[model samples]
Target: MRPQDSPTRETKRLDGRWHFLADPAGAGRAERWFATPLQARDGVEEMPVPASYNDLTTRPDLRDHIGEVWYQREVRIPRGWAGERILLRLESATHRATVWVGETELGSHEGGYLPFDVDLTDHARAGELVRVSVAVDNRLTWQSIPPGVVEDTDAGPRQRYWHDFFNYAGLHRSVWLHSLPQTRIEDITVLPDLDGDTGLVDYAVEHSGQGSVSVQVLDASGAVVASDDGAAGVIRIAGVHPWEVGEGYQYTLRVTLSSDGEVADVYDQRFGVRTVAIEGAQILLNGEPVYLTGFGMHEDHVARGKGYDDASWKLDFELLDWIGANSLRTSHYPYAEDVMDYADAHGILVIDEAPAVGLNMAIGGGIFGGQGYTTFSPDTANEATRANHAQVLTELYQRDKNRPSVIVWSIANEPESDTDASYDYFAPLFAHMRSLDSRRPVGYVNVMLSPYGKDKLAGLCDLYMLNRYYGWYVDSGDLDNAMLHLRDELGQWAQDGKPILMTEYGADTLAGLHSLDGATWSEEYQQDLLEATHAVFDEVEEFVGEHIWNFADFQTTKGIMRVDGNKKGVFTRDRRPKAAAHRVRERWTRIRGRA
Candidate 1:
């Protein structure tokens, strides 16, 4: 559902301090913790909402705790919100969560990194004290989307997964208590296209009750350029301004629903007039070939793990502008809605992805590993996992379908795409995505192990996204051989006649380490690696983009390979620029100027 507030809607943000408790033994539910106010209970501590509870304190037990955690807060509904439909909206609840309002269960959601709403109109009264409690589980299993397994160790229960990122869990986004009209507009779908010098906008609205729908296309100056009177129709505008790369031109589609000749609800959807298409070996935006130059980003920070911070996000965009980059991939999962909105307003392109990582068992030594088992076996990533993956794809499409910056939909990142069983598993998912929305192209990130010769799913993709660690994982510290191997691989992929984008290629370098001989893990080596990769990218005719492995340093599970966290970022964890950042700025600025 559309959660954006409008003229007829009111929302109150429930972000701040809340009483927190860790249920390591999983006794919260059996003890009936949600039956009363949590403040009345003993051994309760205060923690900040909209942030991960992992690194918020000094206790190691709390930092590395598994199982369930509880958050409770008291909110007083506004007296003016009487006669309105009140709803409790959780922007995100990591992994899984269940909600309660004074012993009465509201609802439960299974996925993380997406918004879900629980009806509160009949459960609580307006202008009254309402207690809200949430129980979130950080456990993952074979049935989970990004599948994982829990091992019973001598110390305690251990969570293991194949993904490189850390498992930062809790409420990592904002929560809201919003009010809407009883018979209000539920959803809006806007499709904008360019025709010669005219703009055509096709729209469809879904409402709860019967009403007459009226739509108006307004330009940037708030002038009505086109109008239509129906729930689903097309509005055409003459002398329209097409939304081009690096030019944030948008038109507002104002939708109003009327019942008995009176206005019931109004929603203003901001959209741009543009279209995405792929020619022979070129990715087109508005019928013009466009080059993508950016990095694969993560929703991570210094203390706030995967939490949304406005200041840090703004700084990231400023740095992107300084580097002269145009696009980025929401690596491994879909990012926050605020990030998508900023990309829309600032003219930065995005490749929206699903949380379908770590589907391979060979890397993580999963339960079926060393047993001659495939990744798509009945005991592993089988039908249940695929079903969950499809559900996330549906939710992702529903949430970001209207954003103009989202040009491509990436199904998964570095899945096991080489085996025939893997192909059988993902083929239907790719088709399912197309059935959901046929306007955008869909693809998956190919790992180095699944090269052009062995990958079976490459024939099914609209474009090829390759993540090769040539100089880092493959030919370590050998730039000459690395470039040769990279060129050979690109030549093999060019035979498919599809546009290729290097989604991830980088070396981990310490922030302060420098070497005159270009040794691995040194700042100079990172810069040299990038330069060498860029040289290969320019020589390939089918290459359309070059996105670095990571934008900044981020936290990960502790291992001998990582010092504190992954040091593959061009910038430090605190947004400090490294030597590679300067090299990238110079190279990308020249490329942008040439384009």
Candidate 2:
């Protein structure tokens, strides 16, 4: 029974338990891990799906360790899904994987945090079982890992990053076996008409073998307000509604694919009809001047680590809500889809990015291990590497394009930008993203405040975001001094005539676990900094809104003069609130007149 509606439509996931395997690096080489007839036989170690692997590891370390994680699971098709087309999907696999249906090949997918799905109507025997195998890439991004402790090397050389935070591997998000139709809504391009307040919905079809498609638009009450014949790319919804953050109005854009009037596929996505543009040096949300207030987040917590479960996501969202955050930066990379969905539903704007953090920028101020960053200039390179980077962007767009919460698509985090030659290589990569979704903006956090690359491609991005650690890194810095440095940095972008975003800023503190007496780790020190930061933040409304250095204390292998990853989260690594957290929350409350 193929889907009478849309077959390729993806389902929204809430919760489920997933089985995972704990093995060493390269344990699953060439499908050998789960190749055995009995091995693909399902029901291994049942770790919770949609959970991180770090929580289950015995090492309980943040960095400098060797281990591999192999994940396998049994998927039960819901009885209700018996008659429809079903499939198995993963929001991300840490490294690589080969999926199988009882020894028969379905497909293989790689790249962490990228979503991929496989057809199951034919391979799956209605109520039968299926197995998913994955081999992750924890070793390569070891240095790139946030911060943690490791005591073994049954694996390879430990990879470490100079920055702060831990990198937990495994199926850190969710695993799902969904039901779909033969032909369904594969993708959509909502080119809302802003000129006359009309809506244009352009959608694509996913069919098995070959078939025709029918599309329609339904209002909140389930009436066919607009309909189109054939597979026309555009359908107009007259009298469109607008969506703004505080206003909270939304619509469900539905596309139905049909074969000879029999429904083949159906896709329903919730989106707000709105436009985001740059007015000089500012971001206009829904045609209104807006400010971005939030914190940077890494996917690590104290004891639980990457194995953090769905409950952890709830905790994170609760904490964010309490802190008055309207936005979140998936620091250095993209995060679990559900996390972004929560933001979308809850009204938190997102900056979805690729996992292209470059360590070529004078690593730890020591050997500059990862300084050249993305292009692999004199570093990691091969045609495969460049292709991998491009794949990441494509995967990101495909997985999250329907999300109204995602406002921007960043190509690389902070690539070294002090030279023209670097920009020459970086330019084409930036252009590639524009090619995919010309609807959103693309950007990167700058290496440092420099005139060399200020707004070099203003058309490429709507806002110029700068990531700086000035007061903490360069000056002993009073807030005023930091302001001067910030102003100096902004001068170039101002000349370039681009809106600015103070993208990353804030001093790290251990939240509730602060050590008094030692001013370096004291709560007072962090509070004073936040106080100063807010004071200056209020004054710099003309630049761009600010998101603090971090939302929670995360892992980092760049254990420099301190412990793993900077312990600067407003809350402790375990989600405990710090003194500074309260201060910042209170300040925001005051700003909103809710204190």
Candidate 3:
């Protein structure tokens, strides 16, 4: 079916500012930094919005790094913008940030990989220049993990098992100012069901002024399959085919608003129909078992650093398919909507992560599993931890629920959340997710050893996944040994029997980079590793799925081999193919036909 185009963005803009290193000492130092009166008379320097500190600063010879940066920009609403809902929308800033408009405080937002906004409608005056100041803090504190924290059992920090990806910060996404009439569409949701060949949607429109709202669904032929009068607050769409990974069913959504019986606003979004589940152990895509050759991915390009461009996703996906991967993990954070939609339409599965990474490492002297790390289980969690957990989970679920490629709402990958209560923390959130949409699975990579551990959480999950690094962490390169380890572990679970999925595996590679001994982070090493891992799969009937550690090389703060991130990607960051990429592609694409 033909899909409708998304709404054209607001043409109005206020951008360009100078960034500085922000510290307590600089607190009151930059009032003029955001002073619009100063800017109008040519006070502050000009820099683009949704930019990085490294990109706009004097730090030229750069390495893997994150720190505090200050941004000051000025904007003035013309008297014409009176009564309009004006918002300061920042797609993301690295780490945590606080928004201050002049001396008045606006709001504080956390997570560097998602979009957030603050209402600045009443904060600014007509023809009055308002200063916008931001403190982008990627600093390390008890509650934060700087880009480079990993654990090594041997001695000083050297080796550990963290999903290898770059930790690029700063405002890495688009920033815009939106002006709308009092009544407006606040949020839109669409859920696709391929088996039933139907789609469901719930659009929440909030308004300060009363108006008429309506929703319409159009198919490929530009014919409307559905149109219904919508409440000013909420509207729902039913019996529509949801988006699918490969079948290519689509529909366009057109929401219209009217005041005094005349149209005031319209918004459009195009989407497809698909469903995902963990039926027993294997991942079910549109009701069919899908064994995944998945790759964990990052957004930063090698040269571009924290900056982003649209073309790279296509190149990235091309290399991924060439390597035979069926899934991609936008590791440690949520990705842009375009990238998310592209994956869904092109037959790739996604594990859309929240922007909370290495939270445990920041809390308990730097580690992946600890008792107080995560409040995934809300029942017994401390108020603060649970609050953060609830915040991240809620925002992630609400933002990305429409995409068909998303299968898992991962809470924390390596959070050392060791407690029987950990499961309780997750139970409510997982239940909440099911209440929202019952077709997807919700789980995290195993980290803590709680009373509920693997034994209990296994059954709680529709699909069980592990971030096991036997070869790198345990030094067991033997397949026979690895298989025995996997079997013995699941043999215990065969009693209550939950199907297993290897969400993470594989070693770090330096691509064509070789050692003095002439062996690079070689294909031979990865081949031996995959061979043993496959042996486990061959022997363990309960083991039904696999997603290797990463898709491409990314930036990071920890050391893998002289690099902070594990170069373990089957391909390099620049899209160069490593030997393992071909090997895995042959394994998954043996039966090949494309839409």
Candidate 4:
């Protein structure tokens, strides 16, 4: 079944050319760029609105830009939309964003991986051209999630981060000016479950103005199946067709807000009826245990550089399908809503992750060897950063909670979970995530840390998601030694009596390189390492899944260790497969229906 677009009342696409200016000195606020028309300003240049400024030019300086950049554009609100509640919606902004409509300051939002909106109802009159200015800052500091340092160099203050990826900053997603009724539905939440033979849908809706609400649940044929009149209630169908893996079935939910028998607003949402549970060291999907076999992917490419592209989107799914993959973890952050929609329709499982990468306290260390033995402390685990981390998790959950494709939520990527501060910081955060959606399992991706007393927060996770690079990082090129260490570690973790997923394990090999001796950086070496890793995984019944480190190569912060970029990808950056791809396909295909 093809996925349908989200229903909306009225919308005007706000993409295309916009005036841009780099503000390295943070002079935008001082100069009051938000208070005046940007066209009158001198140093403004034309730039595409829904793109990263770093890759739009060939200049190396622009590609490595740090600090704030202003983007201003002229928009005309529809004349007929005067009585409607106008909203200026930005799909995503990098790091931090402040929006101004005309001279009125709408407000600011922190964090960049989620959407933000500004109500432009009182700021602009309909049928008039309004100046909209947005200030985006991509700088990172110790006080920020994914903490870093700003060093003053001879040229200027250089922005640096603890994360591996390049800071591709700007408005990296689409923007829109949409309209809705004043007495509109604020939010709609749907939690689907199986109640014996009946399909149960529990929902809660929030609205702004006083109005009587009627909710209707429609099946695939667009016929109303169940309904109720109120703000929140459950609607159950007599016999519900369950959404299964590799086979998708979805239902439409329409909520209408009305006063005096006239409909004031309508919100249309789509969801699937399914249940995800953990049954004694096994992950059960729709009451059947599933073995996850796929890769941890990134929203990355060569030219786009994290900017969303339709062609890449289509190609990605095609390749995944070709390689016989059933699932993938949205490795480091929540992906675009459309990506989730695609997965929901295609029946691909997802492990939604938060943008809490680089939370580890060890800033600089040896590339392969462990960092100079540091632990999480109050300096890196302060209240402000933790609060931001919590907020990002909330936004991520709220934005993607409806998608049935997402079976698990990964809170952080590679945080320092082996310390007392880590336990203190993640205890409340993990509780919050589980509270938001109890239907799905929640966990964090643990790095190369000892679970024997060192990993204090292992109990907090429903599943242990380990990212181990034994042959690649620890033992260098010796798979026998790597497998020996892996077996001992797995044996230790199995004592906890919980399911585990090798969330990341792969050797970085440049495409087309071959060596019969199986040396590092060769395709044969990568395949051999994966074969050894799988052998250990096969021996342990507690091991449920394994997602190779990366689906493809992606750009990273400049480092001597990287050859242009990280080459751990089973497929090259261009989506072409290496020798490991054929091996993975054969393995996944053989165990497709083991349950």
Q: Residue 337 deviation, candidate 3, in Å?
A: 2.8
TM-score of each: 0.97, 0.84, 0.80, 0.95
Q: How accurate locally, in lDDT, is each candidate?
A: 0.89, 0.62, 0.59, 0.83
Query: Using alpha carbons, what is the TM-score of model 3?
Result: 0.80
- Winner on lDDT between 2 and 4 is 4
After superposition, which runs of candidate 1 have C-alpha atoms over 4 Å from their true positions? Answer: 365-374
Best by TM-score: 1
* Per-residue lDDT of model 3, residues 223-285, tens digit only: 888777865322234565545544445677677777788776667756665666665655667
Q: Give a tens-digit lDDT track for model 2, residues 1-595.
A: 1112235444435245455555544445554665653344343455555555565545544223345556555565555666666776766666555576655667877666677776767766665656655545465532221211233357634554444445556666666666765454555555543446676666554446355666667765677767776655766778876655634345665665666767666666666666776677677766676677787787775654654356888999888778877787887777876686677666678888787665335444222244334433434433345567777788788777767777877776665455455456567778889899887767876656343344344445567777766556545445568667666656656665666676776665654445554355567767776676566556554566677777777766454544655766788777788788888898665654464
Off by over 4 Å in 4: 1-8, 36-43, 363-378, 593-595
33-113 per-residue lDDT for model 4 (tens digits): 888877677777888866778877877877887888999988999997888888888877888899998777898998877
Candidate 2: residue 437 Cα off by (Å) = 1.9
Candidate 3 displacement at residue 401 in angstroms? 2.1
> What are the per-residue Cα lDDT tens digits for candidate 1 across 1-595?
6565787788899999999999988999999999977777777899888888899888988878888999999999988889999999988788889999888899998788788899899988889999999999888888787778787899878887777888888998889999988878988899988899998888999998988899999899999999999899888989999887777788999989998898888889899889999999999999999889999988889888888888989999999989888999998788888888899887889999998888876555212233233578898888988998999999999999999999999999888988889999999999999998898889999988888889999988999999998998889999999999999999999998999999999999999999989999999999999999999999999999999988999888877777788889999889899999998999898888843
Whole-model lDDT for model 3 versus the true structure? Answer: 0.59
Best by lDDT: 1
